[model samples]
Target: DQQVKQNSPSLSVQEGRISILNCDYTNSMFDYFLWYKKYPAEGPTFLISISSIKDKNEDGRFTVFLNKSAKHLSLHIVPSQPGDSAVYFCAANLQGGSEKLVFGKGTKLTVNP
Candidate 1:
Protein backbone atom coordinates (compact mmCIF):
# COMPACT_ATOMS: atom_id res chain seq x y z
CA ASP A 1 0.00 0.00 0.00
CA GLN A 2 1.23 3.48 -0.81
CA GLN A 3 1.72 5.75 2.15
CA VAL A 4 1.83 8.94 0.12
CA LYS A 5 -0.18 10.00 -2.88
CA GLN A 6 -0.43 12.98 -5.25
CA ASN A 7 -3.91 12.81 -6.71
CA SER A 8 -3.08 15.09 -9.61
CA PRO A 9 -0.54 13.66 -11.98
CA SER A 10 -0.02 16.95 -13.76
CA LEU A 11 -0.72 20.63 -13.43
CA SER A 12 -0.40 23.49 -15.89
CA VAL A 13 -0.14 27.09 -14.92
CA GLN A 14 0.63 30.38 -16.58
CA GLU A 15 3.79 32.26 -15.85
CA GLY A 16 3.67 34.70 -12.97
CA ARG A 17 0.77 32.85 -11.41
CA ILE A 18 0.61 30.76 -8.30
CA SER A 19 0.91 27.01 -8.52
CA ILE A 20 -0.34 24.68 -5.86
CA LEU A 21 0.71 21.08 -5.45
CA ASN A 22 -0.82 18.79 -2.90
CA CYS A 23 0.06 15.59 -1.14
CA ASP A 24 -1.66 13.19 1.20
CA TYR A 25 -0.21 10.65 3.57
CA THR A 26 -1.68 7.71 5.37
CA ASN A 27 1.12 7.21 7.88
CA SER A 28 0.65 9.19 11.03
CA MET A 29 4.13 8.25 12.12
CA PHE A 30 5.72 10.46 9.54
CA ASP A 31 7.74 13.15 11.22
CA TYR A 32 9.23 14.92 8.25
CA PHE A 33 7.84 16.09 4.93
CA LEU A 34 9.80 17.29 1.92
CA TRP A 35 9.29 18.61 -1.58
CA TYR A 36 11.77 17.88 -4.34
CA LYS A 37 12.00 19.12 -7.89
CA LYS A 38 13.50 17.10 -10.70
CA TYR A 39 14.28 18.03 -14.26
CA PRO A 40 14.44 15.61 -17.13
CA ALA A 41 17.35 13.21 -16.68
CA GLU A 42 18.44 15.00 -13.53
CA GLY A 43 18.33 13.91 -9.94
CA PRO A 44 15.71 15.44 -7.74
CA THR A 45 16.95 18.45 -5.85
CA PHE A 46 15.69 19.35 -2.41
CA LEU A 47 13.37 22.32 -2.57
CA ILE A 48 11.84 22.72 0.86
CA SER A 49 11.01 20.73 3.97
CA ILE A 50 8.75 20.98 6.99
CA SER A 51 8.92 19.18 10.29
CA SER A 52 5.88 17.59 11.80
CA ILE A 53 6.16 19.91 14.75
CA LYS A 54 5.46 22.95 12.54
CA ASP A 55 2.41 23.71 10.46
CA LYS A 56 4.30 25.60 7.82
CA ASN A 57 7.75 26.40 6.43
CA GLU A 58 8.71 28.87 3.76
CA ASP A 59 11.77 29.55 1.63
CA GLY A 60 11.67 32.25 -1.00
CA ARG A 61 8.99 31.42 -3.53
CA PHE A 62 8.33 27.98 -2.16
CA THR A 63 6.38 27.05 0.89
CA VAL A 64 5.20 23.83 2.45
CA PHE A 65 2.34 23.38 4.84
CA LEU A 66 1.56 20.33 6.93
CA ASN A 67 -1.82 19.51 8.40
CA LYS A 68 -1.29 16.64 10.80
CA SER A 69 -4.94 16.19 11.58
CA ALA A 70 -5.77 15.86 7.92
CA LYS A 71 -2.76 13.78 6.98
CA HIS A 72 -2.18 16.26 4.17
CA LEU A 73 0.44 18.69 2.95
CA SER A 74 0.74 21.22 0.17
CA LEU A 75 3.47 23.05 -1.70
CA HIS A 76 2.88 26.53 -3.01
CA ILE A 77 4.96 28.34 -5.57
CA VAL A 78 4.32 31.96 -6.24
CA PRO A 79 4.97 33.65 -9.58
CA SER A 80 5.62 30.38 -11.32
CA GLN A 81 8.27 30.41 -13.98
CA PRO A 82 9.28 28.17 -16.82
CA GLY A 83 12.41 27.27 -14.95
CA ASP A 84 10.22 25.95 -12.17
CA SER A 85 8.63 23.45 -14.51
CA ALA A 86 9.56 19.98 -13.37
CA VAL A 87 8.40 16.87 -11.63
CA TYR A 88 7.81 17.46 -7.96
CA PHE A 89 7.97 14.67 -5.47
CA CYS A 90 6.43 14.61 -2.03
CA ALA A 91 8.39 12.57 0.49
CA ALA A 92 8.16 11.66 4.12
CA ASN A 93 10.30 9.96 6.72
CA LEU A 94 9.09 8.11 9.72
CA GLN A 95 10.17 9.28 13.16
CA GLY A 96 12.67 11.67 11.60
CA GLY A 97 14.87 8.82 10.43
CA SER A 98 17.23 9.20 7.49
CA GLU A 99 17.12 5.47 6.95
CA LYS A 100 14.18 5.47 4.58
CA LEU A 101 11.72 7.78 2.88
CA VAL A 102 8.36 7.18 1.30
CA PHE A 103 7.75 9.15 -1.90
CA GLY A 104 4.77 9.95 -4.02
CA LYS A 105 4.82 9.21 -7.74
CA GLY A 106 5.25 12.91 -8.40
CA THR A 107 3.32 15.66 -10.13
CA LYS A 108 4.51 17.20 -13.35
CA LEU A 109 4.16 20.97 -13.37
CA THR A 110 4.29 23.02 -16.53
CA VAL A 111 4.51 26.76 -16.58
CA ASN A 112 3.42 28.43 -19.75
CA PRO A 113 4.53 31.83 -20.78
Candidate 2:
Protein backbone atom coordinates (compact mmCIF):
# COMPACT_ATOMS: atom_id res chain seq x y z
CA ASP A 1 0.00 0.00 0.00
CA GLN A 2 1.24 3.48 -0.79
CA GLN A 3 1.41 5.26 2.54
CA VAL A 4 1.50 8.64 0.85
CA LYS A 5 -0.62 9.64 -2.13
CA GLN A 6 -1.20 12.65 -4.33
CA ASN A 7 -4.44 11.80 -6.00
CA SER A 8 -4.21 14.58 -8.54
CA PRO A 9 -1.46 14.06 -11.05
CA SER A 10 -1.53 17.66 -12.15
CA LEU A 11 -3.06 21.08 -11.58
CA SER A 12 -3.17 24.31 -13.55
CA VAL A 13 -3.49 27.85 -12.40
CA GLN A 14 -3.39 31.25 -14.01
CA GLU A 15 -0.70 33.66 -12.99
CA GLY A 16 -1.44 35.69 -9.89
CA ARG A 17 -4.04 33.13 -8.84
CA ILE A 18 -4.02 30.48 -6.14
CA SER A 19 -2.72 26.94 -6.50
CA ILE A 20 -3.72 24.18 -4.17
CA LEU A 21 -2.19 20.68 -3.98
CA ASN A 22 -3.59 17.87 -1.92
CA CYS A 23 -2.02 14.85 -0.26
CA ASP A 24 -3.11 11.93 1.89
CA TYR A 25 -1.30 9.48 4.10
CA THR A 26 -2.17 6.31 5.96
CA ASN A 27 0.63 6.45 8.51
CA SER A 28 -0.36 8.01 11.80
CA MET A 29 3.15 7.95 13.19
CA PHE A 30 4.16 10.90 11.04
CA ASP A 31 4.65 13.96 13.16
CA TYR A 32 6.24 16.22 10.58
CA PHE A 33 5.05 17.09 7.10
CA LEU A 34 6.88 18.92 4.33
CA TRP A 35 6.34 20.19 0.79
CA TYR A 36 9.08 20.19 -1.77
CA LYS A 37 9.18 21.71 -5.25
CA LYS A 38 11.15 20.04 -8.02
CA TYR A 39 12.30 21.39 -11.36
CA PRO A 40 13.29 19.54 -14.48
CA ALA A 41 16.79 18.00 -14.30
CA GLU A 42 17.15 19.13 -10.70
CA GLY A 43 16.43 17.87 -7.23
CA PRO A 44 13.49 18.86 -5.13
CA THR A 45 13.93 21.87 -2.86
CA PHE A 46 12.21 22.29 0.49
CA LEU A 47 9.37 24.76 0.38
CA ILE A 48 7.49 24.67 3.69
CA SER A 49 6.74 22.35 6.56
CA ILE A 50 4.40 21.89 9.49
CA SER A 51 4.59 19.99 12.74
CA SER A 52 1.72 17.80 13.82
CA ILE A 53 1.23 20.07 16.79
CA LYS A 54 0.12 22.88 14.49
CA ASP A 55 -2.48 22.87 11.76
CA LYS A 56 -0.83 25.48 9.57
CA ASN A 57 2.51 26.92 8.57
CA GLU A 58 3.32 29.66 6.08
CA ASP A 59 6.23 31.39 4.46
CA GLY A 60 5.63 34.27 2.11
CA ARG A 61 3.50 32.99 -0.78
CA PHE A 62 3.70 29.36 0.30
CA THR A 63 1.57 27.77 3.00
CA VAL A 64 1.11 24.23 4.25
CA PHE A 65 -1.79 22.90 6.24
CA LEU A 66 -2.09 19.56 7.99
CA ASN A 67 -5.27 17.85 9.12
CA LYS A 68 -3.97 15.13 11.36
CA SER A 69 -7.35 13.69 12.16
CA ALA A 70 -8.08 13.19 8.48
CA LYS A 71 -4.58 12.08 7.65
CA HIS A 72 -4.54 14.76 4.96
CA LEU A 73 -2.46 17.79 4.08
CA SER A 74 -2.38 20.55 1.49
CA LEU A 75 -0.07 23.17 0.10
CA HIS A 76 -1.41 26.52 -0.97
CA ILE A 77 0.38 29.05 -3.07
CA VAL A 78 -1.09 32.49 -3.25
CA PRO A 79 -0.66 34.63 -6.36
CA SER A 80 1.04 31.85 -8.20
CA GLN A 81 3.79 32.88 -10.60
CA PRO A 82 5.24 31.33 -13.70
CA GLY A 83 8.35 30.28 -11.87
CA ASP A 84 6.18 28.42 -9.39
CA SER A 85 5.40 25.79 -12.03
CA ALA A 86 6.94 22.53 -10.92
CA VAL A 87 6.28 19.13 -9.50
CA TYR A 88 5.41 19.29 -5.82
CA PHE A 89 6.03 16.39 -3.52
CA CYS A 90 4.40 15.88 -0.15
CA ALA A 91 6.67 14.21 2.36
CA ALA A 92 6.25 12.95 5.89
CA ASN A 93 8.48 11.48 8.53
CA LEU A 94 8.46 10.51 12.17
CA GLN A 95 9.68 13.21 14.49
CA GLY A 96 12.47 11.20 16.04
CA GLY A 97 12.86 7.97 14.17
CA SER A 98 15.44 7.28 11.44
CA GLU A 99 14.84 10.72 9.91
CA LYS A 100 13.75 9.11 6.67
CA LEU A 101 11.21 10.88 4.49
CA VAL A 102 8.36 9.14 2.73
CA PHE A 103 7.21 10.97 -0.41
CA GLY A 104 4.17 10.96 -2.59
CA LYS A 105 4.32 10.52 -6.37
CA GLY A 106 4.08 14.28 -6.81
CA THR A 107 1.63 16.79 -8.26
CA LYS A 108 2.68 18.85 -11.24
CA LEU A 109 1.54 22.44 -11.04
CA THR A 110 1.45 24.60 -14.13
CA VAL A 111 1.29 28.32 -13.58
CA ASN A 112 0.23 29.82 -16.85
CA PRO A 113 0.92 33.39 -17.72
Q: Who wins the TM-score comparison?
A: 1
TM-score of 2: 0.96
* Residues 66-99, model 2: lDDT tens digits: 9999999999999899999999999999867635
Supply the TM-score for candidate 1. Answer: 0.97
- Candidate 2 residue 2 C-alpha distance from true site, Å: 0.6
Report the lDDT of model 1 for residue 38. Answer: 98
> Can you tell me which runs of candidate 1 are displaced by over 4 Å?
none
Local lDDT at 50 for model 1: 97
Residues 30-90, model 1: lDDT tens digits? 9999999999999999999999999999999998999999999999999899999999999
